[model samples]
Target chain A: MNSTAVTGHEAATHESEPGFYGTSWQKLMMWWFIIGDAILFGSFLAAYGFSRISAVNWPDRTQMFSLNFITVMTFTLITSSATMATAVAASRRGDRKAAFNFTMATAVGGLAFLGMQAYEWYHLIHNGARMDTNPWGAPAFGAYFFAITGFHGSHVASGVLILLITAWNAKRGKSGPEGVELTGLYWHFVDLVWVFVFGCFYLI
Target chain B: MSDTHAAHVEASYRSYWIAWAILLVLTLVMISISTKAFLIGGILLKSVIIGAWFMHLKHERAILIWSVVAGILFAGFLFLVIHFDAGTSLL
Candidate 1:
């Protein structure tokens, strides 16, 4: 931890200290924001649950979706989460190379998950279950589907971008603790959201 | 500050890998169970475990964890109350 703002110690400092958003604090705030946003997504999912109950002919999830592919995707994602955590741990230990490799591995995992999701979306769309089709009775189903998962996908894409930037900075020896930790926070949040999504949309 | 201290820091990271392994197994278990039955309660439990251990939420301030819990509970309560009305069915 750096020292608090003081008189004599401040004079010799050549570099400006980064603000909270500049590194760890910014990442902490992002986590807080994601938590709140997650609640909103949860509400949407809860509403979907409510709608599922209300529908007279609620489609069978097992019939409509396949668990095998998602199973592979799930494994890929969870493994990615592991790699990302390893990256964070390595960064904290100043093993920059390990951190970079793990971060890249995590990004590849994210890409794989997204690719699987894209395939799932294609499968769903091909079956005449367009976002507006409302294969179930509730029209809100499609709305929530696109809105929540789309929002999450956007976050995943952004996380990938950050992972790239972090790796770049690491190679340059310019990456700082806050930056690495903040990226870790974002990666964890993405995985957390998927846990709930898998439960709500695919499983339950 | 010293080489020995840095080594200690590195050693602490070992538990992180263990935590990650536990989470991977839990995720597989949850997906399997999700197919057999709609276990909302179980999902909640698994989430708590992962969040606390893998996500390091356990090391976070009590207030932060409580805030998240309260938010989820409030949302749950509101949904329940709204759906309790007669002729209302939450599918």
Candidate 2:
């Protein structure tokens, strides 16, 4: 998985080398990084799951959350994942304009999602929900809620920055197809992670 | 880079839109499907579409796909292990 493996394609130098495996080394590394991230988030969610199930007085998340807004945020992320797909696809076809446009749309979607998260957090905090304290059934309720969601949100924030930078590179014609695809993979992973987080915190 | 690259570079735009619509519908259905089976089904559908198609894992090398599968399996194992001792004191 070293950078040296990609000598076949001229584009490999700037974007990534095609590795021992069929995929690019950088792309493979991104996949591995995401797998690690999945484990981290999975552990947190698992802990939260057990904690809530074991606790006698776990608060009802459905009632605690204003579902409409958070639902909007989730949809925004879903949209971003789709746009990211198109961006990578367009980049692969050498459609620079379309790739840049779709990538920008994805970044904007990420930003909108963050804005919604911030709004949700502000009201949740103002309403006396804290990682340390809440009138809810157990302190663990507030604790895991913020901890897990914040961890996921931070990923989204960074993902948005990544998309912005990637989009900028694409606009400048400096990004390779592999680079765009790798960025899309990261973005979609973020969206997929949110699915579980949403299920655990809201639907469950 | 090769003739078999298939969708390595371009994908069906319509499929992406269809996947997005499916996700939106599933989210709406989330409110009604709290049962364990439905929950698992929803997650599976969402995960497959996003991972297999949206993320283009379907065309990736076996090493990458298997590693990700291993990661998910391990995560599931974690859930199982924690479920057995879910409420044990964290501190």
Q: What are the candidates' individual DockQ scores? A: 0.41, 0.60
What would the DockQ be for model 2?
A: 0.60
Residue range A1-204, candidate 1, lDDT tens digits: 211111112212233444533323444465667677777767876676677666666667686678878768777877777787777667667788987898899889988888888898788777767566656445556676777777778878887877877766654556654456666767777777777777777787
Question: How much does each candidate deviate at the interface, measured as C-alpha RMSD after superposition?
Answer: 4.0, 2.2
- What TM-score does the predicted chain A of each candidate obtain versus native chain A? 0.83, 0.91
**Which lDDT tens digits does candidate 1 get at residues B14-88?**
766776667667767776665434457656766676567556676666766776678767756756865654245
The CA-based lDDT of model 1 is what? 0.67
lDDT for position B55 in model 1: 63
Residue pairs with backbone overlap in model 2: none
Output the number of the TM-score-best candidate.
Answer: 2
State the fraction of real interface contacts model 1 keeps: 0.36
Candidate 2, CAPRI quality class derived from DockQ: medium
lDDT of 2 by residue, A91-185 (tens): 77888888899999999999999998998999888889999778667888888988998998998998888788788877777776777787788
Model 1 chain A: worst 10 consecutive residues (lDDT sum): A2-11
For model 1, which pairs clash?
A20-A26, A50-B91, A52-B91, A53-B90, A53-B91, A54-B91
Query: Candidates' TM-scores?
Result: 0.81, 0.90
All models: lDDT? 0.67, 0.81
